[model samples]
Target: MPVRSPSLVELNAFLAVARAGSFRQAAQELHVTQAAVSRAVLRLEQELGQAVLARSAGGVSLTPAGTQLRQLVEKPVAALQAAAVRMRKTPERLRLRLSVVTSLGALWLMPRLEAFHLLHPEVEIEFRQYHHDEDFTRDDIDLWIAIKRSAPQRWPRHIAAQYLIGREVVAVCTHERARTAQTAPLLLAQPLLYHSNFPDNWALWAQAQGAKLPLQRKGAGFDLVMNLIEAARSGMGVAIVQQCLAEADLASGRLVIPVPGSASTGRGYFLCRRRAQDAHPAAELFAQWLMQQAGAPPTV
Candidate 1:
């Protein structure tokens, strides 16, 4: 059976006016006068045998019939826009989307990412530096490198997790403080600083060492771990920092590791993603390259 239809132009005009809730606004969008938009709506209403809009003090509103029609059109319109965008995008290049904590992004991943790119020149890697948290499903992240003290509660479907790196806390201080703290009580007495995220890290380490001192009363705390390390390096106070983050300072003789014993925090860096068994071509290549670079175990 043949179906009769209203003009696409008139339907589009009706949609614009309905969305904007004003003839003037619709006219601006359609590049026509307000009277032209009014005419188009009236023509559409006549063809559909229904009133699509109601004029009121608030300017305009969709009638019940218009609301239903608008709902039907909205998704298709959005889909068409999306399709057009995808079609316009060049297919020759592959885009890899990744997200990671700022600390890791700066200290660890950024330096190493170039190697991955060198291997996969055709793949255009896009990195999103995430500060707090990430929604694996909603955020268009292909690879997620998260640094944390504990593992996540859940993982998305097709996502696989692997331990990327391990770092342990060490007492770091300037050369002068290192020279001064040669004994036990002095170790506990030095205004020990803390990282905000690990508020009780100093206390936990002290307790682990069986050195019962006034750890809580000791010092100031900084939010960023790097800032805490910088403070320690400048001789502000001794800080328990991850070895990986402090290795450069320690090696340069600017900061010294005061305590040899380490408190097992069971915290480390991890790589997680949606597809467990499968990996994007670029991701797979990078993963293999990373394991080689880090000397990760065969199982990892």
Candidate 2:
């Protein structure tokens, strides 16, 4: 006779028995009788034409075939269980979860969020800051804002992205420093503040201006652009930052561009989201609003 396939009930019973090492214990765990658990496991063994468990006075133990099956199904079963738990915990309200760089969130998005709220009061928003690299597919992120030299070549195939705005890097410092320095070389001589993520920003800006910055100079380094801007504003040092991030400070006279020209990094920010059969209404609304704010064409 040909071997038959085991049913889900039988497989679950076998797994329970293998884990507990006893029909009585497995039955207790499953809230079923010992005879029912034994019958289920026996049915599975008969279908597969294998003695899946060994019975002895000491206790029950899985045979080689049972061990192999357990190993194959454990991860998939765990994943299903986890997915079910997530579905149960998800809220009913429309929520958009966005992951963004710390500086952009603080300087640009936060200031404009209230307007979005007023317009779409029923929609909820959650912002998460990722200071380091992240796997967008595995995280519970609904969308992401990424800054790159150009469109990323190695992004996951499941994600769709649209260009938002090109970044213009400019050197900025307090008004006092601006008054003291009349030339690019003088500005470069001050303690240069550095953004940890874009450590070569100043050097790149200098190279764009047909000048070379000394790499040997020591400066205060901050992981977040907002902190670097604050350091520059406090007169600690001159910092090379994205022009968009310091627009308010520059307009308010708290900071000044020490250099006359800004360097185009040939880079821009991209709005990214997973490709799905249908877009979430809240996410779509926010994405469109973001594009409008960035001066980009609205996403369809």
Q: Which candidate is the best by TM-score?
A: 2
State the local distance difference test value for candidate 1: 0.69
TM-score between model 1 and native? 0.60
lDDT of 1 by residue, 1-300 (tens): 765777767777888787557887677656678899899889989989989899888689999999998878755654453344335557345677778777656655666677766655666878876746665554577777766555345544444556676545667788788777655457878888887887767766777777766735677799887788888977887887766666566767788777677665666676776542232555544554664555532120
Full-model lDDT for every candidate = 0.69, 0.75
Q: Note each model's CA RMSD in angstroms.
A: 17.6, 17.0
Instruction: Summing lDDT over every window of 10 consecutive residues in candidate 2, give the lowest-scoring window.
Output: 77-86
Local distance difference test, candidate 2: 0.75
Cα lDDT tens digits for candidate 2, 213-259: 87677678998788899999899988888877887788788998977
Which segments of candidate 1 are over 4 A away from where they belong? 1-94, 149-158, 276-279, 296-300
What is the Å distance of residue 209 in model 2 from its true position? 1.7
Q: Which pairs clash in the backbone of model 2? A: none
State candidate 2's TM-score.
Answer: 0.62
- Cα misplacement distance, residue 286 of candidate 1 (Å): 1.9
